[model samples]
Target chain A: MTFPADLVGLLALLGALFVLLGSLGIVKLSSYLLRLHAATKASTLGVGAILLASALHFSARDGGASLIEVLAAILLFATVPVSAQMLARAALHLHPDLAPPQPDSGSRQTVPEGAEVARPNHGNSAPADRL
Target chain B: MIAIAMFITGAAMLLAALRLLLGPTIEDRVLALDTLYVDALALLVLMGIALESRVYFETALVMAVLGFVATVAVAAYLRRGRIMP
Candidate 1:
């Protein structure tokens, strides 16, 4: 009906498209880790776009914009990555067979208990626990 | 336009449901559940826009918080073999 409305329509379409892609990815991806990569990254952007469109559409109202949608989006943004990593860790622990094999480097290094992977980017040490 | 977006979001939810049903592992099911949560929130926000109401946004916000907690708690249980660590 109006320019702003048209813009909101486009934003909604874009957001929904991203969300659909993310879902499809989870269904079609062969590996659990790959699916996590797809579901978290794409869905986060998708929901963010939708929330942005919602905020814009409600901004013209008498009470001003709705901040709830924006806050929800932020919460989604902040937590999805952590949840993904946690899920990955859990998956690895739960189904050790599902974890990908590590590249072979012919040197063994002992890792201290409770600190298998001290840091992700740490130099090559114990490749067995790199998952 | 909003109706079209709603349809698309609904389709996404369907696919997420499919994943939840047929996932090979617990982690896959959890990921699908997480995806469904976000898609549901998007639909809720769209409904708010279409209906010209702000109440749906509040509900979506609550859903977001609950979904995160569920995800984290489940992952924790899987990791430590217990819910509380």
Candidate 2:
């Protein structure tokens, strides 16, 4: 789509930021489930924003191509989440063990006189849930 | 206009791929793949606009469908050790 110099730069920058965030999530998260959440959310936002900007830019430049522009955004909205969810479900399947083990939050305990109560022992598995 | 964005987007995709390759577990790779699909789709659309051709959108749509199916199929296979499971 043809856009003025300033506007095109701005749109591109915004789009890039969105994509960057999505990519960043991959490295930052600890587990597959967490990574899936971050990756999918950021990617959707990134692509959605960029496409939206593109649609606007294109519409402003040429009136006739408006339909295509709208379609672009719609397609992004409809497809990204579904695919991401599917992938995430698959990932959990692939590595059932990858799901974060539940955290062992110690049971509530009264402090003994001059002695600290011991936290609940997490035996073998960490006590925690996933993202 | 699109050239710069495409470059950046492509770079970001590579960064995500780095995680995909190095992830400690199979699930991590799947998450990376999910992100990759999104990035690829975005690139497809941007390319369409850059080249001024609606033809790219068709490819993008096919990508959307194909990626979803593949992901779902893979997930099923992983979950139960069988496709139906």
Task: Please provide, for model 1 over B1-85, each residue's C-alpha lDDT reduced to its tens digit, 9 standing for 90 to 100.
Answer: 9999999999999999999999987888888999999999999999988998888877888888889899999999989988986
TM-score of each: 0.85, 0.73
lDDT for A34 in candidate 1 is 87
What candidate 2 gets wrong by more than 4 Å, as runs, is A1-5, A90-131
| Tens digits of per-residue lDDT for model 2, B1-85 | 5788889889889988999899887667766776787788888877866776667767776776676677667666666667774
lDDT of 1 by residue, A1-131 (tens): 88778888999999999999999999998888889999999988998999989888888664576677768877889988999999999998988877765543222235545664444555766664544
Off by over 4 Å in 1: A103-131
Judging by lDDT against the true structure, name the best candidate. 1
Task: Report lDDT (CA) for all predictions.
Answer: 0.87, 0.70
lDDT of predicted model 1: 0.87
Clashes, model 1: 0
